[model samples]
Target: IPDDLLEAARIDGASEFRIFGSIVLPALKPIIVTLAVFTLLGTWNDFMWPLIVLTDKDLYTLPVALAALSREHVQDDELMMAGSVVTIVPVLLVFLSLQRYYLQGLLAGSVKG
Candidate 1:
C-alpha cells in the first residue's frame, strides 16, 4: 500500500499529504469508492450483526431499523422503496464520483493484445 502510494508520492513530489491529495488518492479513488460503497451497503443491510450488537431498536442502524420498520409496516410499498433509496444513494454518489478511475484502471489493465 505504502509502496504504491509512496511511488506515486515520489513522482509527484507534492508534500506527504499533498502527494496523496494530488496523485495517489486520485489514482486510488475508484478502488476506495468501490470499497466504501461495498462496506456501506454491507453494513446497511447487515441484519444479524446489528441484531446481536444492538438491543435497543432506537439505536439500530439503517438496515436493522428498516427491517424492523418493514415488519411493522409490511404493507407499505412506498416506505420500502424509500428505504431502498436511502440505502442506495451513498453507493450511487460514490460510484458516480469515481467513475473515471474505473475507466482508466480498466483500460490500463486491458492494454495487451
Candidate 2:
C-alpha cells in the first residue's frame, strides 16, 4: 500500500492496529517469508551452541550427533560424506523453496536509505 493511502485511512479514522493488520502485514509478506526461511536454515544448521549445551547423548541435535558420528567413524570416508549430506539437504531444500523471497530480502536490505 502507498503512503498516501495509509495517510487517507488514518485521516478516515482507521486505528493503528487495523492499519497494520490490513496494510502493513500484507506489504511485509515477502520479508517475513524471507526471514522465516533464513531462521529455519540457521537453526537447522546450528552446531556449536547445541554441542556446548546438550551434554546427554539422547538430547543431542542432528549436527551434534553427526559430529559425534564423524569422530567415531574417522576411518570411514563414506559415512562422513553421508553425514554431511544429511546436514546439508534440509538447508538446500529450504533455500530452493524460498529462493525468490530470500533474494528479494537481500536486495531490499542492500538498498541505502
Clashing pairs in 2: none
Best by TM-score: 2
TM agreement with the true structure for every prediction: 0.60, 0.65
Model 1 per-residue lDDT tens digits across residues 18-110: 866765566676687678777876866778887898988889977777888899999999999999899778767866876777787554322
Provide the overall lDDT of each model, using Cα atoms, as 2-decimal numbers: 0.73, 0.78
List ranges where model 1 is wrong by over 4 Å.
1-33, 109-113
Which stretches of model 2 miss by more than 4 angstroms?
Answer: 8-18, 100-113
lDDT of 2 by residue, 31-101 (tens): 78878887987888788998998889998878889889878888999988888898889788877887776
The deviation in Å at residue 47 for candidate 2 is: 2.0
- Local error of candidate 2 at 6, Å? 2.7
